[model samples]
Target: MERSYPRDPEWEAMPDVGLEVWPHSPPDTAAYGEARAQALQAPEVEKPFSENLANEALDIPRSQERALSYRVSALMASLARLNHCDDEPTQADMRLIQEQRMLVAMQLAGSPSLQQRLTNPAWVADCWSDALASLGAIGVRVENLPEDCPWDQDALLDGPQPNGRNR
Candidate 1:
């Protein structure tokens, strides 16, 4: 006689999700609702010093509002390019640039009150010029990736150990 193990046919046929999904209790209704409400109620954080200076520049009244908005857009595009191109900066410097760019973008995009303030031509020009200069100063040369990687340099090991080390 042969011993046999029992298994569920349906379970065996199920497709693999790769992760184990454990059975869990339904979320507590009140707690879940409260958590979502709290998330939604979180306050906006204060802008940093760099952003404050840029905002001040933008706030100065100018006749060419459209041009200033276009300049802001151009600055944002340059920042994105710098980030994508592997121009390495220290983490703190990167953070500052990102913060300033985002604030400028937000002001350009949807903030009517902010947009109203960012009209001065001189200030807007100075703000973007300074930002560009700062970014240019920190950018390092981008290096090209090697055609052959270090891992690929190693030859594959075929079947086994020499010198009485066979497993």
Candidate 2:
């Protein structure tokens, strides 16, 4: 007699959604990281010392907003091209772009509202869904996938919060 491991027949063959490959959460993190990277890259406003560093604290955030906007523009273009390609991007390739998309959406949210962030965090679930839905129509689902992404949250928050709070 041969020994066999018992398992749910429906679920036994389901693909593993490891932490790295989880579609939703990881991509969100990556995009925020990249957005932050962009913000930090922002050059100090060319000043003759008259600007007086005009709030270096807030200036840096503006830099980030600019960076995220630029990156998201590029990503949107790339996504459009992917959609029009002679051969649709593979699931793997689509997922990679979807991660970038999630980042942009997160950036769009800007900083967490004073009443937001770790508490009753509604930003991630809804806007993320909207962005992913648009991408999904093109065949790439940004569901629970792993994150191998680069986002820049610090920069994105520099502009304004999506809910119109963090100006």
Best by TM-score: 2
Q: Where does candidate 1 have its weakest 10-residue lDDT segment?
A: 150-159
Best by lDDT: 2
**RMSD per model, one decimal:** 24.2, 20.2
Q: For model 2, what is the alpha-carbon lDDT of residue 137?
A: 67
Which regions of candidate 2 deviate over 4 angstroms? 1-51, 110-167
lDDT scores in order: 0.40, 0.44
Q: Model 2: what TM-score?
A: 0.34
- lDDT value for model 1: 0.40
Show model 1 residue runs off by greater than 4 Å: 1-111, 140-167
Summed backbone clashes in each candidate are 3, 28
TM-score of each: 0.23, 0.34
Tens digit of lDDT per residue, candidate 2, span 45-152? 355342443344345445555555455544543443354345546676556566666675566455432213212224333333444455666575344321211223
